[model samples]
Target: MNNQTISAQLLSPFNMGDLPLKNRVVVAPVTRSTVGEKRLRFMAKYYAQRASAGLIITEAAVISHQAIGWLNSPGIYTEEQAEDWKQVVNAVHSHKTPIFLQLWHCGRASHSSFQQNGQLPVAPSAIKVNGDYIHTPLGKQAYETPKALETEEIAAIVQDFSQAAQLAKIAGFDGVEIHGANGYLIDEFLQSKTNHRTDKYGGSIENRYRFLGEIITAMTKVLSPNRIGVRLSPNGSYNDMGSSDFRETFLYVAQQLNQYGLAYLHVMDGLAFSFHELGNPITLAEFRQVFTGPIMGNCGYTQETAEAAIEKGDADLISFGRLFISNPDLVERFANGWPLNPLVDRKLWYRLGEEGYIDFPAYASSS
Candidate 1:
């Protein structure tokens, strides 16, 4: 494929609903594990550095104290936290780049150490994550069996997502993406392996989807459906996710979400993150068939692969996580064929410092 042709496809301008993008490339949300009072300033710089991307999804911000698990990660539950994030939004908007806040709830992925008053983490079921360890504020600790949320308690958590969406708007975010992927709180409710409840929120696929469905309904009350997005990781094994009915579950999810007319459906279709290997992985084409809205494909997409996905009509936008981290000027590199910086070491990915976070120079500076 011609480099210029490749550039035109991936780095080209596109419209996701009413939102116009400068390019089709997206800065996927990444957990830096480096947020604190002092780190908020760094967070602003970190996101502002890559404002050239078509859209930027800020790292998953915990929706409530019950939603926190990652150490030092930002939270949007309080007015003060939302005010802090407003600065980051201003920094990105300074470049005329549209950014979205990803509302997250860690669910059973968290430990009591991260919870208030040392209460057990909550989930749809009482099962514990199969993972060996979770990084808590105390230290690296074993995964704890979570408290199963009662049917009566589900409404409050759903309202938390709604309140978080409203807070995101107040923070001046152009939009909000619900973090429903990668074995997090929402994902735990979606997958059968994790959700073992017999209430209205569990049992069959429709019942299982009720938790996320209610979240969307609640969020739409504060934010327009067009200003919202949802992420799904049907093929991932992260946090011990993936079920026997994975294909049926996600396709049904897409079909239902289609009725909502969301801004986009972000699907992690690439196997770069280990796949569950239960059966054949679900593809973007599968989602495209059901979801009528714009589709964003993520996970391990190179310029060539991203270009192909868009050119083939499989994805309207392609998000880059590691690439965006290393090459802040990823769109320019694809447009001009500049050499990309080497991938940073995994250990340094979540470290709290400027060494490997925002120190990488763009091609203009490097050359």
Candidate 2:
């Protein structure tokens, strides 16, 4: 496609709520999965490099100590962590780019090695993730059956989300996105495949949604609904997800989320992450039916497909993950018809330091 045609769809400016985006391209959150003292250092420069995106969602940041699962992933619980994040926000903001922090919890996707006193991870039920192993501080370990959260204990986790939102605001993030997808804590509660709670947090669809509902409600106290976003993966099979009632579950979720007037509803509609194949995958057009607010289509979208989806009114924005890693100047390349850099090696992805993380030169510099 010609540059004009490409710019018309993907590069077009958009007003996401009251925020003005220079373009519709977004930088999706990607976990580098690094550990140690170097974890938070280079992030500022890394994000600033890709500030051209309409919106930038940082890699998932665990909300609290209990939420810890990824070996060396960033966290939002401590004031120190929030303080460190301020540098990243300032760096991105210096380029006039809006960035959002993705709040996350690993839940049953975690191993006891990452937990306090070797305590087991917490989930809605005492079920183990059917996956073989997970990377923990001690090393790769077998997935353990998580301890079922007590009904009363649920409130603390909800508050942790709220507190994380508060810290995101303090860190100068434009907003926050709740990581409710990919079979994590909230996903465990949302899908029946993992959640078998008899309490208010499980069983019926509404009950299953209660955990996320409470989280959203709590977070809104710290930030307006318009400043928050939630992500869902109805078609995802990651972390042993995918339910037979996926359609009913997500449709009900969209319908309910429509009430909150959120910043946007991010749906991972593409099959890059692999689908559950419970039936035909639920498309962005399906979500558009229930949600009247702005919607972003994520996972495995290319310039052509993202453009087509926008033209068809199926999505307002598209978030690119792997592509953004190698092409720091992705928007510029797309605007000028420059070819994207080849995908980086997978082993280089999660390692600490500059190699694959921030060393990818922009198109101009590379030329």
Candidate 3:
């Protein structure tokens, strides 16, 4: 089999709504603690380095002060942050690359030390995530019980997302991808195990989906339906999350999202020992059955696997995480069938400064 032929197939142009990708290869969102004033400067160089990708999805960015629970993660709620992002958007666009910001909220995954005035973490329930540690100014410690959000508070959260979407547009982002996956606040509401309430926000599947549906509706008011996207993890067990009926929950969400005519649906197929272990695994062909829009599939994908997914019509595009981290010219590597560089030290992933964040040499530099 000619690897070049396979590589060409993977690098072919694809469409998501009105946006045409240069190739099917996408750089997935990966948080690396590169934010604040320094983050703006670093991202300009960082994204500019990987401009070869067909599309670039930035790391999850908090939308509100209350929504923030992680250290050093960027936010779009403030004027300064929005202005900082403007530079990032300008840099990526200068290279003619379309970029999307992943809007996020940490929910119960946050530590009090990271909260305002050291307030408790918030979630759908007051439950504490089992066997998880959070970083504090002092050091890493076990997660604590989170404060349950009231029905009224939920409405406020929706408004925060809407405001954030507007800010993203102001920042010159091509689009906004709602971070509803990976056991975050939105995922907390989706999982029955995490959300145990008798109010309108909990219980039935429709009620559980109400939070996400409202957020999407609110965001669409600010961003066009075609310019908006959503990310989900149907069978993700992260943050001690699960449901009695995972497939039914995700199917309902997918079918409903299809009605909105969104740009794409990005799905994370939980961390599995093998690809076979990925549950609620919505293949590109399977997802097309429910959602008429484009689909981006992620998790444990190799170059060959991603190409096969696109060829088999399992996905319109493939999202690369660690591969993009090590290979700034991943699209070029895929196009030419060049061997990829191995990932550097994991300890440096969140470490401040440019040691691992911006110091990775590109293929040109290596040559």
Candidate 4:
């Protein structure tokens, strides 16, 4: 295609409800274990560096202390935590970038050491994932069977999500994304293999989707329905999760979410770039038909692949994860067709320092 044709086809703005994204590039939610005060300066610097993207989704911020099952993951339940995140939000906003906080709950993926009073992790079913280990202050330990959440407890958890969304807004996030993906609590209820409950939250596809629907409804009241989004991994088998009726589960969830008139649906295409057994092998285009709203495609996407996805109407937006980890100015590089800086250290991916976090050189400096 000619330059004009290519530019016309590849570069276009997307309207995510009331929010107008300058382009289709989004910085997907990524977790770095900077919690409380430590995360304030670090996360602010990190996001401000990548401010060129149309939108940035902050790492999954735990909804409550009970919901936090990982070491150093940030929480949104307290006033102090919200205050700390306000600085990060302000930093990104100063660069004129819109950011959304990804609200999360680990469910059975958490260990007792991470829980208060050494309480058991909660889930729809009291099952322990088979092959995963969790790091504790004491040391690494095998996953433990979680306590099945009682029906009453489920209501409380939903409220926690609602409260967190409110807190996120207070923290000055442009919006909030409910993390219903990656085998977390919401995903646990959505997947049959992980949820054996016969209550209102499990069994039939509709019942299994109850938790997600409730969460969306609750969050919508706190934030406008047009400002809310959800991230899902339909075929994701992460954390020992599966569904005999994957199509039914995801399709129903999408249809239900569509009724809310939410801003967008972020779908992680698990089978795009690899031969992995973890996520279902669904294409981003397939999910497009199921979800009529704006869709953000993620997972193993390159600049060319992302551009193609936008050109073909497979996705209205593209989210970059690890690539953004090393190259904060990823959108500018892509716009100028510049070479990417190599990921120098994978060890620093989850490390709690500014070495790899803030020290990556921009294209101009590297050249």
Candidate 5:
């Protein structure tokens, strides 16, 4: 496709702080089982195929032994794991793609088997969000009522995140994105419904946001604030999450994050799965009003819709999830106005091997 056929907004060069890109399209993180060395090899190939992205955010990797919940997700806490990740960085960098490792902790969304010595999952409170199930080695199990982290223990978790950020740097990531969304550890603290702590960590909005702010501060010691970005889902029900005062809480959080001069704010809303039904619904535009840095709008954005959102000034960039999974050449397809491949095999998302993982054909082969 010629440059004339591509939409100007998407193909136009853009700058997101230290990240200069050929376009504003990003490949959002997607979970793949990290069971062994072979998987990391697969992961390297998985990311390299989509290196055309302006920025690639890797799947959420657990920060520490205490932070695991996803049964098969990858990690970066150990020296060996970091060494393995170096291969991934080399693969993506070969194509000159800028990538970020997303540091995460599952919090209460975990079962005993995933934790060391069968220890209970940890969170801000002993509350359990029912209806959500976690996959364990034994099999899928219901969510556990997590052990409440003592004030001292809370600090340890922060340090774990700090350590992980440094490890990510050592692994050769361009930067890191804190996974502060999707009802995980950081999100558990931010939401009033989940955080019942009476101490400084949980009463009001500021208290709830304290945990997230401290994490950002810690990461900045090793990486530039301009190179750091955060993902938040103020209106998501993915992990059975919600609060009575989501608007006030999230707006306060957004306003505060602006002070750090972050690279971008990636938000997920307006999709059937990410509904904000319980509270006053907030949009990306409202966040734009509060945060000066760029905002990336996620959750099922088509090429036409993404371009329109950018033109309307609602978002500086648009991230693709499922589309990127099935179309390795998603940007090229969109740029050339080629029809998207609607054949997504969801059944193989968690299955082992490369059939549905790295086997998706590029545009040339598919056409």
Candidate 6:
């Protein structure tokens, strides 16, 4: 299936199973923890502004009370939150765009202040991943050694994700992407450095991958495999996540996910902020080899590099992170070769205000 080497092919249509995409540009989930009707209202407008993107993966939304680690971050475990997210989904769909809600659990990257009754944060093991701080209502706090999830508690976490998938459907989202990336709950379970358990949820590579596998299985009871996706950062050092078996674990995980026939596998392939810098890097091609479906390459992707990736068959889609924040019309700018709005202030990124949140101006039109 040879396609044309068109200049702005990123603007072309793509069909991810039953979901048809207008372009290959995806809005990677960024942390925006401004919670409330006021903030949700602005967020609706924010996502609507970027409707030209083929897909918009929302900021990580907590699955349950136990999953809240970020300050004022959104949640999907309640009816109120689901009702609130509908506004954002409806706004984006008004422009005929598809959006996927990203479900997350921060695991050991959290503080007890974010947990119920100040209970210790749950993780695969009782080990602490240093150099990570979680913002609490009080203030920023360092990560503490987490409580190893009891065998029974692991099932509860998987149930939380499954229930979140059902709520996302009620919230009018096109689909849901399991936040298996970074050093979140699922990531901690996947890497050996964090997962030292001897149960069915850890130990061997297959056992470490079971936590996510169980989630995908349970989530499928509500959403089909075609409507579900998973994001993975096999080479990440973020939240202090890495392992001795980085290459072997991710490859096997990718191979097994193929059996589920999911929509796509979103992989963090760039070296910037990656733990693979000190070791041999694993390429996206490795995942593509076994997972014979759509692959979305993320991190540090520019228009030129993204186009090259698409041309060379390295990726079926490219998710833009910081670029999408400053340029609401990123797909349009890339399609027409328009100048992009440079990101001005990094501090405003996580702040709870409209200063840099929704104030990024679109390109000045040349009449």
* Higher-lDDT candidate of 1 and 3: 1
- For all candidates in order, the CA lDDT equals 0.91, 0.92, 0.82, 0.83, 0.85, 0.87
1-367: candidate 2 lDDT, tens digit per residue: 5877966878889998888999999999899975355347689999999999999999999999899888668999888888999999999999999999999999999988878898999999998988778887778888899999999999999999999999999999999999999999999999999989999998999999999999999988899898899999999999999999999999999899977889999999999987899999999999999899999999999888899999999999999999999999999998888999998887778887677888899999879
Prediction 4 global C-alpha lDDT: 0.83
The deviation in Å at residue 245 for candidate 2 is 0.3
> Per-candidate TM vs. native?
0.98, 0.98, 0.95, 0.94, 0.96, 0.95
Better of 4 and 5 by TM-score: 5
- Tell me which residue pairs clash in candidate 2: none
Tens-digit lDDT string for candidate 3 (1-367): 6668787667888777788888888888988876654335477788878888989999989988777766678888877788989888888888888999999998998888877788988998898888658776558889999999988889889998999999999999999999988789999998787889789989999999999999999988898899998998775777677676777787788889988999899987635412223354545466667877788988878888888887888688888888888789988877766778887667767866677777777776687
Whole-model lDDT, model 1: 0.91
Off by over 4 Å in 3: 36-41, 270-285
Of 3 and 6, the candidate ahead on lDDT is 6
- Worst lDDT run of 10 residues, candidate 5, spans 32-41
Off by over 4 Å in 5: 1-6, 37-41
Please, what are the lDDT tens digits per residue for candidate 1 over residues 212-243? 99999999899889999999999999998989
TM-score of decoy 6: 0.95
RMSD (Å) per prediction: 1.0, 1.0, 2.1, 2.1, 1.9, 2.5
**Lowest-sum lDDT 10-residue window in model 4:** 1-10
List candidate 1 stretches off by more than 4 Å. 37-39
TM-score of 1: 0.98
| Model 2 spans > 4 angstroms off | none
Candidate 4 C-alpha lDDT tens digits along 49-133? 9888889999998898788776677788888889999988999999887899999999998888878899999999998887658
- Candidate 2 positional error at 356, Å: 0.5
